[model samples]
Structure formats: C-alpha cells, structure tokens
Target: MKGQENKEEKMECKKEENLVSCLCTYYSCSRKGVCCDCIRYHLKSRQLPGCCFSRDAEATYDRSFEHFARLVQEGKV
Candidate 1:
C-alpha cells in the first residue's frame, strides 16, 4: 500500500542521515567497533565522542567533557 511504501521510504532516509552524521572513522578499525573505541578514547580525555554531538557541534571539535556536561545541564542533550 502507499502508506507502507511511505513508511519504508522514511526509514531509509533516517538510515542515510545516521550514516552521514557519523564523524569518527579509522580505516584500520572495524566500522562496528570503531565507535566504541572512539568513545572510550574521548571519555578518557574528559570529552564526549563525536557521536555524542550533533552534526554542527561535532564539526566544532568541542568534544570537551565539560561542554557535554554543560549541554546536559541545560537540557540540550
């Protein structure tokens, strides 16, 4: 039905958006595992990982944990 087709199209668009939003990538790392590793590295540095941020914020490299905490405090998360 037309409604079912529209729902599938929307899901596809969301999947593409998620892929486009991904920021951290290492050729040597498995794609599925890279996110976990990247998050750990950022956390150890007192920062939030790229995936934690919106596209614009991630582009700023403002991955500071303090920034993340502040966003959370402000209910921006």
Candidate 2:
C-alpha cells in the first residue's frame, strides 16, 4: 500500500512538472499534461498530438498526417 501511494505521489509530481512545459492548447483534455496518454490517444486515431503542430496549424485542430504534410511543405511544422 505504501509503495502504491509513493508511486501515485511520484506520478502527481511528474504531472505538475509536465504541466509547466506542455504546449497543448486544448483546455479541457484529461491528457493535457500527460504526454504518454495524449500520444496514445492520438495515435489510436491516426493523428498526432497538438504539440506536434505549429501554433496556427494546431489551432485548426487538424492533427492528421495529411495536415502535417501540408505544414511540412509550407515550412510551418
């Protein structure tokens, strides 16, 4: 039980640290500061996380590989 509690505490600390550097613009996502969860969720949907996109591109909410390609071509990614 103590070990589990310690693990939970460590996770919380990491989350707090991650929040400081996370650039995801979504305000209500449960995985906002949790990179692993966000990546897994997006990958399952054949998309990438918001942080992978540029500010303007990310604002469009089009996280598809196709969009990324466009951004890359436009030198925005």
Candidate 3:
C-alpha cells in the first residue's frame, strides 16, 4: 500500500512537470499533461499526438502518420 501510494504521488508529480513542457496547443485537452492517455487517444484515431510533430506542423492539427513522414523526409522534423 505504501509503495502504491508513492507511485501514485510520483505520477502526479510527473504530470505537473509534463504540463509545464506540454506543447499541445489545444488548451482544453483533458490529456494534455498525461502523455500515455494522449497517445492512446490519438492512436485510436490512427494519429499521433501533437507533441510528436514540429511546432508548425502541430499547429496545423494534422497529426497523421503520413504528415510526420513527410516532415521527416523533408528534414523538417
């Protein structure tokens, strides 16, 4: 129980830290600071999270794998 409590506390701390650096432009996102949840949600839609894209690309809101590949091929990533 103690270990579980510590783990939960650590996760909360990590979420706070992640929030500070989260580059997702969607301000109302519930999973903004929760990377795992964000990834899962995006994956379900056959897309990647905003954090996976460059600032400009992320702003476009096109988190498709193809878009990321194009950016990578163009040396923009």
Say which candidate scores most in lDDT.
Answer: 3
Computed on alpha carbons, the lDDT of every model, listed in order, comes to 0.63, 0.83, 0.87
lDDT tens per residue, model 2, 1-77: 55455343334437778888776788899998888899999999889998888777888888998899988998876
- Which candidate, 2 or 3, would have the higher TM-score against the true structure? 3
| Candidate with maximal TM-score | 3
Q: Please, what are the lDDT tens digits per residue for candidate 1 over residues 1-75?
A: 654653433222243355565764433434423455566777788887777876666667788988778878987
Model 2 stretches astray by more than 4 angstroms = 1-13
Per-residue error at 53 for model 1, in Å? 0.8
Worst 10 residues of 2 by lDDT: 4-13
Could you tell which candidate, 2 or 3, scores higher by lDDT? Answer: 3
Over 4 Å off, model 3: 1-13
Runs off by more than 4 Å, candidate 1:
1-21, 25-33
Superposed on all Cα atoms, model 1 deviates from the true structure by an RMSD in Å of 8.9
Relative to the true structure, candidate 3 reaches a TM of 0.80
TM-score of candidate 1 against the unseen true structure: 0.53
